[model samples]
Target: MPDPIRDADPTIAAAVESERERQESTLGMIASENHVSEAVLTAQGTALTNKYAEGYPGARYYGGCEHVDEVERTAIERAKSLWGADHVNVQPHSGTQANMGVYFAALEPGETILSLDLTHGGHLSHGHHVNFSGQLYEVEQYEVDPKTGYIDYDALAERARAVDPAMIVSGSSAYPREFDWERIGEIADAVDAFHLADIAHITGLVAAGVHSSPAEHADFVTGSTHKTIRSGRGGIIMCDEAYADDVDSAVFPGSQGGPLMHNVAGKAVGFGEALEPAFEEYASRTVENASALAAVLRDRGLSLVSGGTDKHLVLVDLRESHPDLTGDDAEAALSDVGIVLNKNTVPGETRSPFVTSGIRIGTSALTTRGFGPEEIETVAHHIADVLDAPDDDATLERVSESVDDLCESFPVYG
Candidate 1:
């Protein structure tokens, strides 16, 4: 079949084809990315994109919204079932915006927000000084125990007492360990603060029961639909019914206008797919592959933060094993060989954020492409080979060829 986009606009059509080819050819190891299914892709490209449903289902500001209302209702119901939440709002454009919605609903401007430090695997929306959360609210940060690469709950409790923040944010972008959500919630309660668990990177894992959920522990939970969940590209907020109206209004008239109805349809489709038993198997395999990759990297004498991972990503700190190799250089070398990951700042990062001391690699995309433990171990060796001698032309060419062969063996789309 011919592509309609090619007939309508050749330039954008070429870029889209190139991107699809790129994903098929390369290994996507970025911890925050994954490939959505064809059903989800089709849903996002539907005529629902032309609608403007400015309010909730059955109560929209527009008149011709009956079909979109059904889609939005399905998305909300599936999200609630998937995460066991009492209320869900699937309107925020991104995970960061989801956090904004919570902040707007719960805290007044200039109130304090205590969260994990960015260099220690926290996100920008979790009170990084440059973000709106940091600008509008006074931000206090906590860090992992540098010696053990784990969060110190005792220290966090103490800091919460001192800061007396309005909200406490839990979850991370690159941290390889699971959070003690109940304990964090207890601390938040003790401090009289709302707990916001930003599980942007582990939504599918949580839904699949491969990771502990914060839904029961935190006051609010937020996640990106596109990461491990492989849903549409948007954000979702989950809360108890007590705060449903506040959250809904904050997401609608307070921060954003009409919701992206096409993305909501995609979310509905993807969430429906996730409710199947196969998604649990996929989520379990993703974690297992990540563990295998971690073991191989450690055997190769590479140092992993926290000594290992319980999720889909491993954070490799090069300060000890490869002190001279910066994360930027390692990322470039890996990219040259068709492995796509990102540079990341470690717990005690000394270098700048752009050229950090560590790299974060994930197995979600490869796992989606059907890579198992054996394949993941092989890829781990390739990573070590390139990082061991990043400048060797002969090694680069050999690894590039090997990567091409592997990508051919495990095609993303067929």
Candidate 2:
């Protein structure tokens, strides 16, 4: 039988097929990406996509939303169970939107927000000048300790006290170490500021108890459902029950209109999967694989942020070890060899963000592909080799072939 997509639009079908092949053939090392389970993929493609459940589950604006209401409710309840939050909102379109909702619910425009500096492993949504968070609110940034490549909590608290921000964001995109959520919460409390912990990059780890959770420490917790969680795509927001109405209204009327029901369905399936014992094993191994990768890179003389990782990713600073090599060049070299990651600005960065001095590698997708510590060690060696001799054709060829073999051996899809 002819494929339905191909029959309707050959161009899109071709691109989709190519993308699938690409994902199957290469290593997805992006710290923010993961391969969702088949059940999630199927759920996201269901008839729920046709619904417009503009409001929360039992109180939708639309009439024909009974089924979608169930889906969204299931997603919310499952997320609450996974994170142990007092209230959960599974309707945010993305992590940024989730943040926006929180901000709208809790702060006024022109209010101050203190968060980690972007060049120091922070996310754009955390208050970068280019994002709404910065343009709308007064933003003050803190940085990591230059010598240790870890958040300088002392400095952060000092700055927070000085700025007296309305909200203090505690989470990172490129930080390899776990955050001191309790300490950050205390800092926020000292200033009578709300704490928004954006755990977009480590949602799965926190859910599986592999990393420290901020749900208990922060006033609000936000995360991407797709990252380590392996939910197809979407974001989640959690807050205490006291703030539930404000958060829900902010999400529905303040930030976005109707929720993306299909993605909500995907979140439901993924959250259900995470509740399983096997998902706990997967999350644990993801961190273990990351540690294995870090060990190999350090052994090869690569300078890692924080000197190692306590989560699913490693941030490699190239400035000290390979002063001449830019992160863009290394990223391109690794991509050529079928290892897909991203160029990231490291702590104490001297170069532009586009041409950074560091690269971020992750093991969530590799772990999802069934690659263990031994496999991760091998992949890490290949990465180091490629970075060491990026211009050598022989080296690139050898690493590319090995990457292909590894991808085949550990297929992303069964």
Candidate 3:
């Protein structure tokens, strides 16, 4: 088969070829990644890339942007329409940069922020000491309820009251349940702080109405255009009209130079797809598959963090199921059989993140590839079956064969 990427960029054709081969050969189960439509891929390589529009449409720093003006405007309007935001900035290169714009627009360099702990599902941009957001700001951490393995709304508010943060952040990377966004909003109000919702992982689901929309309760909502949105790689910050100017400026001269017009075009296409009714079905089914897999795992007496999943990902605690197997080992075992998944830290992880006691499995990709509850169940059983007897190359081979069978039934990237 002829790969379009080959003809498009022969300079990087080898890299593209290798990446496509990897995708075709294995399951991409990472919650944060998704397979965008070929239409999206095409849009991302449009002729709009030749322009250098450093400013907003109609207010550019350079000329020859007449066509790009419509592109930028379309992207802005579609993103705003999809999310119901008073203002939208689809210029950030990625989620982290989108977060940077929010921080720049809303805070002084040394202000304080109270957010969920990174290990507890919070993004690094929320304030891990290693990230720029943490280095420039004071960060207070919150945790999930130990017993429930989910955010403790009450505890969060208590911490907000004590820290008196300049901002309160809500969202998680590995969290399996819906968050109390309204409660977080109330906490921000009580503390007279701005509320920023990092819905990067759930943006698609939220846009499709399968998950709660933070735009209603948050002052600033940041998300990636990919994930559930299944767009290209980029970030968006949606907010009220009150901060639009600051937000736009922060993204342009403040954080990035020229907006990647190709990425913006892809975002526009993705936003359009999200506005479709079928997108809702995709989002819902993604969650359903996650839940189904969690059930099968739990039914086999394996303890799942938070008991089960309410979203498209599950954090399976391995302490009981694979007594001696670290998350790293299980991840390798699954990979050996083409059942790709990432090892992640559970709350109060028993070991380091690199060798944790849990695996984080997400169903957005598999579901998008057309796997439903039945296939998810098959995947769950095969994972448990193989990991139960790790080092059994025979079981790994069998699982790999089954994976290929399911994948063949629903062709990916065809």
User: All models: lDDT?
Assistant: 0.96, 0.93, 0.88
Any idea what lDDT model 3 has?
0.88
Residue-level lDDT for 3 in candidate 2: 95
- Can you write out model 1's per-residue Cα lDDT over 1-414, one digit (the tens) per residue? 988999999999999999999999999999999999999999999999999999999898999999999999999999998999999999999999999999999999999999999999999999887899888999999999999999999999999999999999999999999999999999999999999999999999999999999988999999999999999999999999999999999999999999999999989999999999999999999999999999999999999999999999999999999999999999999999999999999988999999999999999999999999999999999999999999999999998998999999999877
Stronger candidate by lDDT (1 vs 2): 1
> Please, what is the TM-score per model?
0.99, 0.99, 0.96
**TM-score (C-alpha) between model 1 and the true structure:** 0.99
- At residue 16, give the lDDT of candidate 3: 77
Runs off by more than 4 Å, candidate 1: none
Provide backbone clash counts, one per model. 0, 0, 0
